[model samples]
Target: MSSNGTFTENEEAPTYAPSIPVPNVQELVREDPSQVPQRYVRDMEDRPKDTDMSHLSSLIPLIDFSLLLLGNKEELNKLDLACQDWGFFQVVNHGVAKEVLQKMKDVAAEFFELPLEEKNKNAMPSDDIQGYGHIYVISEEQILDWSDALMLAVHPSHYRKLKFWPKSPTGLQEIIEEYSNAIRKFGTELLESFSLIMGMEKEALLGLHKQLIQAYRVNYYPPCSKPDQVLGVSPHSDSSTITILMQDDDVCGLQIKHDDDWVPVNTIPDALVVKVGDVIEMWSNGKYKSIEHRAVVNDERARISYASFLYPHDEVEIEPLIDPKTEQLIYKKVKYGDYLRNSMKTKMEGKAHTHVAKVETLA
Candidate 1:
């Protein structure tokens, strides 16, 4: 398996097999709502057409020219509304240069193409530091996501030691380092906008910033012999606060659940999809939602994606929305570390996550 999570050769393609059913929305909602919470479910009873994306081209908010170039509270609210209600949206002219975006895609492709022996040298040995290569090996968490990934925890400046990076790219390593730094700057700016919309101090999310860890997962989905028989990754919601994904231009494997229907998220040039994750969902008291999404591979070509995860320090406490009242609190306060541990434990046992509890809660 050459870091693509599957063996690749120019040889004859092997027959494909279907993957067992991945946990889906109806099944999730079928569980006790209090135990397995998702805002999309509760709203579905009163509104029947919430998930339809057929006419979504118009329905999906086209961010205005001004909001795309300049940031404002009102614009942030618009973005937040789309996130809360739609769970996914695309933005263009978002400031990051087109060349920079291409570099990220190219470098990720090059990294995955490296020989397996060289790539494994950078494999993560422990789950703690978010090193590099395949964290899912020991994931012991839900079913394994089919793709192989590289993880980088970049933050606080000091934690970004070169040891955690691969030596192959040589100068390319420096380029990635710069890229991560730039993304952090942009991530903070986006978070600031989100904070303002949530009615919190512009810097309210700053303390949790210390533990701000930036993770990059370079995932490769090899062309499956049986493309329709199996999935590249299963359906799952992100556990962090936010995720910025840069998809390869040629692949059309990304999809998201909308109004009880699955809509394809075709990657657009110069567009980045910002996904709201669990922590932000909880912090917003369900005001903002963490939507479930997945990736599927094609039999014709391989696919790659650069997914960057932004998370708070382990000790940071996740509480209700900044407001005292918001649709009645959906969850109790918990630490990010606790949620991670619970996810790991349940995943190891092959169980779908419900509460995403903090271990300390058990204590």
Candidate 2:
């Protein structure tokens, strides 16, 4: 993938395929529980353990889209608090038809269910990060996640590479395109709402005519023999302005770091998870944090999620949009292209990369 986020096919195959064939975790767990590779195991310190949930009784806020459209004051207040305090929320009664959501889930499951060799046809090139493959795998000794992902650009349709898209899953392309269009429109509305919540004009932070770029990640977290030791995705905040996630209804693995504890985000029927990304934090001048979150694998069932990220055009320059009464500019102006290039060089673990963009202040 280029700095502009376009993917090009490289004829050469990657030289870094694992020495041992990567076992299909979904099938292997159903047959033999102990076949999990040592590389997939986590150290004792990184394992998941039973934690107290009683203190986390207050679930993340769920904002009704109808209320947002109606401009209800109370609902708008909730949206503000959710962004300012939690940086994550569930949007219920969202306009996307139930049929569209179901079809997206169905197609995603169907695509991942294909045989490993069949799925490899869409494998990403060694240099491109926008197809079926693992990401951020820098070394053989690094711990691997118990997941597989298919990533592709959805918006600015010209950036899409149809060859990486699955043709076997009947109607996959049509449904995904329809779904992507709907989400792109809805995501724009949400960004406008964010500006209003910040007491600015609807398009103050985000420009009036700025074109947003959308990318999709279809994540497949297969069942793991040692669920406690492996994570589906490592902890990291998104690099986009906002991310809308369509999670598997029957699975529960998405967790958010809250006040030193990892709390599970319960799935709300027909609701999409809205996340504040690093760009938003910079835009807000550090007033709202980009939450740290991760996904864990299930012991018996596989998990799937589709995340749509809304980003600014590559040429856009990002600068802190500070509100005189509340915020002071904390980050310097930088081009989106430069930021992305610098970010790609670092590991996606925590908010360290975001911190790099911050301006140091002296006492």
Candidate 3:
């Protein structure tokens, strides 16, 4: 089957699928702890360690949704400052039902617990980005993260390939649909709020697109014997307009780069983590920043996180909006599709594709 869950039209049936076989990290660690792959290990400089977290308390701002919903001026100012200065924040009482939130996390964990063969049924094709599989595997020698993920396009319901969706977990489809819809609504509301925070007419930023591109990614990070040596996800900024993350409440592994140190993000119960992506930075004309973040594996417990990425429609032309008061334009106009492709290519290489969109000026 193809990555999109469609049958391939090959003239002759191949002995094996074109995709590489990924071992179940959870199973491997249980069977033989000593057999951990060497490729998962990182160098000394890349390993995670305990550091002084005195300044962390002020780094990540937490905002109250009740205040945002009521249009409280003080809270709105705080939101604007968080976007401008920190580029990351946690939102409480965002209106998503607690039942739905718990079910979303439960379904994700259940799907990953399925047998290896069943899970591999949705394995992504080498050429495609959707379905269950490893990402950023460009070469044989490239280091692999001790993680697995299931990714799918959720918006524009017609774009969904239902065959790739899991069936073993009863009610998985229904819960996921409900959760995605709630997230979509929340995202639109947040975008409008952002417009207000930016001093533009409400919906000024959101009204540019007729349709929004939304995708869901469920990440499963298995416990590693040498947690310090392996990363669950590499350091990189997202390529979307905004990314909403549902972190694992019981386990902590998410961290963001603050200055020269990596500070852990403390998980707040029933709260969602918001991240500013590269596209937003471009649209804001560099007024907002897309910060770099990474995930590390837990030594004893597995970690699961759900992230929904909001993007401009494929054909949308993204550029810095005109501001009469502004002295110069920092970014150039570019098609969303072109930027996405370039971003994917450079993502694994530890380079920010958004840098290419910067316009040069004589010093």
Q: After superposition, how far is residue 301 of candidate 1 from its true place, in Å?
A: 0.9
Q: List the residue pairs that clash in candidate 1.
A: 50-259, 51-258, 51-259, 140-347, 140-348, 141-347, 141-348, 142-347, 211-313
Q: Residue by residue across 83-145, what tens digits does model 1's lDDT show?
A: 779766776666677878778777777877776667667655443434444443332233344
Cα lDDT over the full model 3: 0.79
> Which run of 10 residues does model 2 get worst, by summed lDDT?
11-20
Query: In candidate 2, which residue pairs get closer than 3 Å at backbone N, Cα or C atoms, i.e. clash?
Result: 1-128
Which tens-of-lDDT digit does each residue in 1-363 have in candidate 2?
455443434322222122222444555565776677788887887777677553563578889988887878899999888888888999988899999999999988999888878888887766556778766665667777788888887767776777888786789889889999989878887877888887888866557215567889988888876788888888888888999999989888888887868888888788999999888888777777788998888778889989998887666778777655675668877777567656655656767777667776710
- Return the top candidate by TM-score: 3
Model 1 TM-score on a 0 to 1 scale = 0.76
* Candidate topping lDDT: 3
* Top-down TM-score ranking: 3, 2, 1
Report the C-alpha lDDT of model 3 over 1-363, residue by residue, as the tens digit.
355433333422111113344565766777887566877777787777767564684568998987887888998998888888878899998999999999999988899889878987887877656778876665566667788889887876766777678786899889889999999888888888888887888878776654677889999998887787888988888888999999988898888876657878888889999999888888888888887888888678899999999887666788887673764788888887677767764435333566777786611
Task: State every prediction's TM-score relative to the real structure.
Answer: 0.76, 0.89, 0.90
How much is 299 displaced in model 3, in angstroms? 1.3
Question: For model 3, where is the 10-residue window of minimal lDDT?
Answer: 10-19
